[model samples]
Target: MRKLTDFISESFIWSVGITRPKPGQERLAALYITATLAASILAAMTMFLLVLHRL
Candidate 1:
């Protein structure tokens, strides 16, 4: 049982490549998140407008 569990755990860890972040990468990540959120908001707003127009 322990061997099986260790194998599973090791496979999971190797499957994920967790690399250290480079300098100033936090700002880049923040910008990406902001842009993604903005895009989602724009899409939602456009859909809402379309639904209202059809009514």
Candidate 2:
């Protein structure tokens, strides 16, 4: 959990363009965050739909 929280914080920082990220690093970090968010949302939606279908 702590590691997850740390990754999220770092991703947020990179996305916000707050810190002086190294060349190409910022884009990679931002992409990582965006992908993570998209995957999470998709997984949640799938689970919700499955539950609804089961009911």
Candidate 3:
């Protein structure tokens, strides 16, 4: 679980062209969380539409 979390955080940082956060920078973490939630919501909507179309 720790490895997965670290991998996701690293990937998000790399995608955004940023280095690891320095101390006291919480906004980066919040940005990552929001982005992840948005992506997940989009993925779920896509899957739902696909399934509905097939039915």
| Number of the top-ranking candidate, with TM-score as the measure | 2
TM agreement with the true structure for every prediction: 0.56, 0.60, 0.56
**lDDT of candidate 2 vs native?**
0.71
lDDT of 1 by residue, 8-46 (tens): 434433565444236667445445544565688999999
The parts of candidate 2 lying over 4 Å away from their true place are 1-11, 14-24
In model 1, the Cα lDDT at residue 9 comes to 38
- Would you list the C-alpha lDDT of every candidate in the order shown? 0.58, 0.71, 0.72
Worst 10 residues of 1 by lDDT: 4-13
Which sequence of candidate numbers ranks them by lDDT, best first?
3, 2, 1
1 versus 2: better TM-score goes to: 2
lDDT agreement of model 3 with the native = 0.72
Across 1-55, the per-residue lDDT of candidate 2 in tens digits comes to 4466447747677677666557757556556665777799999999999999999
Backbone clashes in model 2, listed as residue pairs: none
